[model samples]
Target: MRVRMTGLAGVIAIAALLVGAAPASAAPGDASAYGARLDVTLLGNPAVHAEPFAAANANGPTQNTFVGVDLPGILKTGVINASASRDDKSGGVYSRASTADVRVDLLSKVTGKISAELVEAECAATQKGLVGKSKLAGVNLGKLGQVNADPAPNTVLNVELAGIKIAEVIFNEQYKNNDGSLTVNAIHVKLLQGKLGSLGTGDVILSSATCGPAGLPIPMASGAGLWIGLGLLGVVAAPVAFVALRRRAALNAA
Candidate 1:
């Protein structure tokens, strides 16, 4: 039995499977949501809200959640695993997980929706948490424009900042789950045409910060990379600048 959580056209279907199916009339707090069983290789308890729960109480859900993102600098990529209960009476966990989705409006030229799809699923029998892998899927953003952006690939909120095309800005990729943890992937941008410059479509891990929270999931300064990179750049530039100045001054005096 599979419960189907259908999204707008092209949206990934979140279906209840193998365990059994339920009607769509089930309520969130209904008792049936706690019982339907799934075909688990390593059966752990389906996700239940433990004590010390948040006011939202949204760890795993039966209803779909909406997420908004700031793109690029905020988050590049990540994945999310979720189970929804289909049994209105049995109201149990949806056997498989569904990837989150997003809609892109090409301002003027293009507009469509893109959804996230699970690439893999491995829920630990003892831990009860399923780890699912995903990629940017259902990406059909219509026709390509003069810029060469796939539109289907991920793009950022704004195309031009500081007169930079920021072709590889993927905003929807930046996510926030019901809770406020953040995740950032990578960024790529190259200049192209027009007063604003042409752009290309970009991609990212949707479940990351894009599906999660407003606050950052991890701290930025946690790594030594930033400090080292800055130090190296300064060290390499200082000597060259000093030597060039000295040579120029000596030649002028001569």
Candidate 2:
């Protein structure tokens, strides 16, 4: 009886070990989004500077608006609206950023003005794959030709003033982070020249979003069902082994 009980105990222990050895799904990732970031200098002096607006993450959404902005005749905008939001789904994460009614007076004398009715950026990560996209609507660059509504990744448009390239307007900028995350910027403006005649160099970004890598797929039978099935098998097998041992001992005694 003692030997049979020991053997049954071993079988149950093995069953428990099998259940514990099952693979576990990876942890879910995070997401973030923001709108309208400006870091520019005017006349060799740090004049116009503002952090990203309406930044949001898994915690909650954010929104803001400005009636008008005048950067001492260097930059100007009218009725700017920005918003950002993030969502965590079952097996993935999603983030979005949007802006509307944005107008920038880029060296009015040299380059007329740039305006966009709407700009948006989106990012999502799931078991299937990572997806990112940017949209520009009703955009007009005074001298620079028409803006591409659906530009490819990291598309750059040279900003030429008086036949001399001064800046670059990058659209749909995408970056693959080291930690398996992705960042997407709807529009990014980088000043190539050190000085725009008298205005200093700087960069501006609008409608940006980022999301971590996709979560691993969950196993079909990895949860409670797996443990229950293993437990039942052990219970039945243990009793059967005990009964068989008892019968054998009785026959040997007889």
lDDT (10s digit) by residue, model 2, range 1-254:
65666677767666665555443432456677877778877564655788667677654554555555555554444544444333323457777777777676654555577878888888888767778999999998787667689878898877776667778788999999998889999988787646444345788887888886765443324565466556766776777677667767887898
Top candidate when judged by TM-score against the true structure: 2
Off by over 4 Å in 1: 1-102, 106-132, 141-163, 171-254
Which lDDT tens digits does candidate 1 get at residues 107-221? Answer: 2232223222222111111113222222334443333221222222334444444565433334223232344322222122222334343433322322221111111212223
Candidate 2: C-alpha lDDT: 0.70
Please name the candidate that would achieve the greatest lDDT relative to the true structure: 2
Which whole-number lDDT from 0 to 100 does residue 248 have in model 1? Answer: 65
lDDT to native, each model? 0.27, 0.70
Candidates' RMSD to native = 28.8, 6.5
Question: What would the TM-score be for candidate 2 when compared with the true structure?
Answer: 0.68
Q: Which ten residues in a row have the lowest lDDT in candidate 1?
A: 31-40
The clash count of every prediction, one per candidate, is 28, 0
